[model samples]
Target chain A: MPERRPKIIGFCCEKHGLDCVTLAARSERQYDASVRLIRVPCTGRVDGMHILQALEDGADVVFVLGCLEKNCYYDTGSIEGRKRVEYVKGMLAETGIEPERVEMFNASSSMAWKFHDIVSSMKDVAERLGPIRPKGGGSE
Target chain B: MIVAERKPLDEIAKMIAPYEKVAVIGCRSCVAICLAGGEKEVNMLVSAMRLKNRKDGRKQSLDGFVLERQCEKEWVKEVEEKILDSDIVLSMSCSLGTQTIGDMYPHKIIVPGLNTAIFGVPEEQGVWSEKCLGCGDCIIDTTGGICPIARCAKSMLNGPCGGSSDGHCEVNTDIECAWYAIHERLKLQNRLELMEYVRPPKNWSTSHSGGRRIIVKEDAKLTPHQKRGREVLE
Candidate 1:
């Protein structure tokens, strides 16, 4: 039996979110969770280029979770993130990959439930999408 | 400030794929501030390029070095010999810096590792808005320090077209109406009266429309190569 593990990468807005993300994946062993979550000061820091970089670096699906729109202390960071996500999704569509591979969602303080739901759904989506053709066979 | 973006690592790797001795250079000016061709990006790119090439079974020679300003020949004088020694160069600067190297060393095979964008300003963090189109004109004075050429969706010089509504451009709901912003700025300064002054149709000679630009001054004459060649050989 081939152990099919969906590779999902997430951009978390905080260390707290990162901790929860890792914990949830560890606790729920149902999916072969090869999730690589990168924590940034804010989701706004994730540029369209960076999202594409993650996909090119080998992520079946990419998600960016940011502070609610207008809620970021950095002023319009969530808006920037939203804009970048849309731009990256458009680029994916142009590049033959479905734009749905990349997603943008809003989050704040104690939305661990929302975070869990997103990751769970992403794992489900990636399982359906299957493994992408890894770049140059350069395994991460 | 100038606009620039980093080149794709795989494409860049492919450029230097044939050469074993590669000299990668970074410009510390425009591209640096843009975080595209800066020192930090140079280091990261070299590492990534190396890994990518190695995976393809080709051993590449790459050494990363950043000049204080790659657009000028003086700042890069110290590395002239090293640059010449390399089989090829990977210019990680904007078009100007990359071309400057090509101008200085005509024989060296210089490959551009970045895409030059435009004359723009940073809007906030990680966002850049183009302000100058490098058009052959300067009517900003009448626009109350706002650029109608670069910002206006239609690049209208005189006034807002009928399309603008609520200070927002019809081109996109999200984008601010540049002329509306200009009008508000002029109104605040009590200089709204300047709008009536019709400047002449701009002279194309003063801008990119004319030809290659040249700035000659008495002080910075005869580059190091010229001066050294004249003084040391006798």
Candidate 2:
């Protein structure tokens, strides 16, 4: 029997980079089409609880896709999101969840080609990791 | 007010393990002011418990709610609706508040999530020490506002043992000798002669050891007109 594919939830910044990966996937032959994407105004708005809720809802992999550092249209949104991601990673480790399951990526709106590469790279990483447990305490 | 600290997460998790539906309760009175049991604590613990449950595949349900004063019967009644739905209640209040919850609802299991410490003031933002051992009698006025029983390493009633040197206690050089504090106050007031009088040992019998102390006065218990009117204010 074939193994079940993981649910990779993507939170993309709506301002300048939300569709970069989508456009890239359409033009590129190597883009991964199995990820779910939710577009928000900016990564800065992503709260710690949001990442926790995603994992609690059974997401095997979560990605915060935002504009490249220093290039975010909303000033520090990308930077803030990256900091939030780091905090969530520490929290996940305490609960026996692998820190790699939660990730943050940066891409420019014009880098549609690079975005495609990032998504494909993300899919490959998720394939190796199994299910993620909630944040407090648990295993496997 | 009382000072308290939350129990370890692992220990608290074990306390609520038997129940599927758990309610994390917090007290906003003493515990809140002391920064121990409050709404933020309730939210954090609830989130942690939910995450733990989800990982275990046990399908647990959890919620959080806080009352203003858990020690009082009236304030505890405010959470009546939430309590009815939970299989167990984990109270993040002082032991008095926890016991009050238990007394109010004998049918449900009320668990304490804090180890209640003695009455104390905020030493800093997050630290509170035992200022008043509840020694039955309060001698703040006589001791220059500091409690010897609490600040002194020996809880010495007379203080600043012979070991106190250069204003520091012998037990620990880092600590300021409580007797030195008293002596300083006495010298400043030109009442150094008061130190010549020997003080008696503390009377612990007037404290919690006597099983709940009470002060009652027939003349001060009520107002004259209210007793005669027999009418209550709604």
Candidate 3:
């Protein structure tokens, strides 16, 4: 069998999340191409369904990137996002999926180094977990 | 309103495993307000199920629909065709909605997605405490508007039982004793005399102990035409 690249999906809060990523790009900081970033109005807007949908779409891991807790552009938006991520983690665990497969991170727009580290950390975890085995009796 | 929580995902997945096509239905009334069964919840459940199918290599299709109110016959009628079209239905609404769907379509398999918790009000953003038992006999007036039937651990009509101390129920120190709350409330209102009145045993027949119950209002009875959907409002 050959090795397969783990698919990683990131739900980024536009206010700070996307800005930080742009900063990382300008600084010429390299990150894995396997990571896909989706920008939303605020991290709070990233519903639990969106996270689950991303996973169902074959992404090995999903992460929610948001503004610092007390500094969210939408007030408690990032905090709400954190709660949502935590909720999905519990659900995944109940379904026999690794809770670590989903994660939430906080950072400001100027923190390009932090954003890079976040992506690297998520990618590493996804690689360690490997592909999810289909439930029931079947071979994928 | 009814408050409920979604059942574990694995349990729901197993229930719908036998079906090839499933409809995930949600209610916009009580369950929706509680964030249990609603349009958002329906979508998430469907998405999670699809992911499970993908990982398991199972060939199943899941769809979502949110009714205005699943317990009402009229609102439920709107999705009659869509539900009938699916191989099975996974209801995200409370048990009432699940049963209502089951009653309307006796032949189809109805899967309950939520565990109906209680009839209560939201004390905070995500916390809900049971406040009503639907005992069919409401005596809150004499209890200073604090219901002993629902709030009391033992449902003691005249309480603050021997187990109550420091205004907390012995069953759980974290819970405030309903009778204690009643006493304070009544005292503040200068109606402490109401508490001295000896109370008689409650009529259990008004509760679930009496078996399935129904309310009939002669004036609210539907006409034959209305029963046939002749007067269904859009």
Query: Which one is best on TM-score?
Result: 3
Q: Supply every candidate's count of residue pairs whose N, Cα or C atoms clash at under 3 angstroms.
A: 0, 1, 2
Per-candidate TM-scores read 0.64, 0.67, 0.91
Any idea how many clashes model 1 has? 0
lDDT of 1 by residue, A21-137 (tens): 545555544433476778888777887657766765667788988777766656677788888789667545433456788898776655556677887888878877664443444
The TM-score, computed over Cα atoms with residue i paired to residue i, of candidate 1 is 0.64
Candidate No. with top DockQ = 3
DockQ of each: 0.08, 0.17, 0.57
Worst 10 residues of 3 chain B by lDDT: B225-234
Task: Give model 3's docking category.
Answer: medium
**iRMSD in angstroms, per model:** 7.5, 4.6, 2.6
lDDT of 3 by residue, A20-61 (tens): 889988887698888999989999999898898888777889
lDDT of 2 by residue, A1-140 (tens): 78677688888998667767656756646656568888889999886667767776777778899988898988999999999889777666654557788889898877787777667766776777667544443554
Docking class of 2: incorrect
Off by over 4 Å in 1: A1-140, B135-137, B218-234
Per-residue CA lDDT of model 2 for B27-106, tens digit only, reads 89889888678876676567656766666656778888899889998888888878878999999999998899899999
lDDT of 1 by residue, B1-234 (tens): 888987665577667888999999998898889988888777656654543443354567778899999888887776798789899989889888888888988999999989998899998978998889877567787898888888988888776889899988999878898888988998999998876777666676887778887768967798888899978964
Candidate 3: the clashing residue pairs are A134-B55, A134-B56
Off by over 4 Å in 2: A1-131, A134-140, B163-166, B170-174, B188-191, B215-234
- The DockQ ranking, best first, is 3, 2, 1
